[model samples]
Target: MPIVYRLRQGKKMATNDRVWCICVADYKLFAFFTDCGLMWLDTKHNIWRVVSGDMPRKLYGGAMVEYYGKLAVFWRERISNQKQEKIRCAVIALARVGEEEVRGTIEWSGVVATIPYVCGFLHCLVASD
Candidate 1:
């Protein structure tokens, strides 16, 4: 049988809320994004936890990827300019502290691109040789 893990949601999840993105990093940590913001499953403690520092304030349909040694989060939002969608990316550097805690520091974040149409990131991938 497969082991089932339950991630704790800090806030009351509404009926329409959905998981936007999930990614794994070093130290056997699994991170996910939702209306609850970015949270990770700490395998050692068998519990879910949130990142320490700055995180995405307005998280909606988004995607996350493991890039190099950091995590890159991508999401979209409607801007004031002719109702265009603003696609943004945030690079977060992770570090483990106090045995079972993982802290995230945003290395950099900005708008990577924009599209005239309204859409969110359905998926994200990073490949290197």
Candidate 2:
């Protein structure tokens, strides 16, 4: 089920940014890929929470989605070779740690694919057979 919460700020949510992707997952957690990193909307508390603040690099041009009730992040990392880079996917299990805090734990992370070009962009898509 999808959950919806009212923004107490009484402002418009439709704004332009470098957000690569934004989607809501199970438990009604909405997320956005922004300059402050991946953050999720806490419906219970009506606040925005960071998914991972200690990520290795400054995130840019990536995708975030929900998979099997967990949050999945598609990020790119550069390798030693200039022509090829790695695209990694991380599965994070988000849980309510405290009354005002939600924690995201990486259950699995792996290289989803390797592109033949540097700084490539990938769009988020969902499909099933």
Model 1 lDDT tens row, 54-105:
7885666677788887898887878865768888889989888887677889
TM-score of model 1 vs. true structure: 0.76
Cα lDDT computed for each candidate against the true fold:
0.71, 0.66
Q: List the residue pairs that clash in candidate 2.
A: none
Worst 10 residues of 1 by lDDT: 1-10
lDDT per residue as tens, model 2, 1-129: 222333877555554334556778866655554455667676666677676534423445567777888877787777784777788887778776666666677888888888875556556547587
Ten contiguous residues minimizing lDDT sum, candidate 2 = 52-61
Which residue runs of candidate 2 sit more than 4 Å off their true CA positions?
Answer: 1-6, 12-18, 32-34, 52-57, 118-129
Candidate 1, residue 27: the lDDT equals: 47
Go through the candidates in order and give the C-alpha RMSD of each one to the true structure: 5.3, 5.8
Query: Which runs of model 1 end up more than 4 angstroms from their true locations?
Result: 1-17, 33-35, 120-125
Q: TM-score of each candidate? A: 0.76, 0.68
Best prediction by lDDT:
1
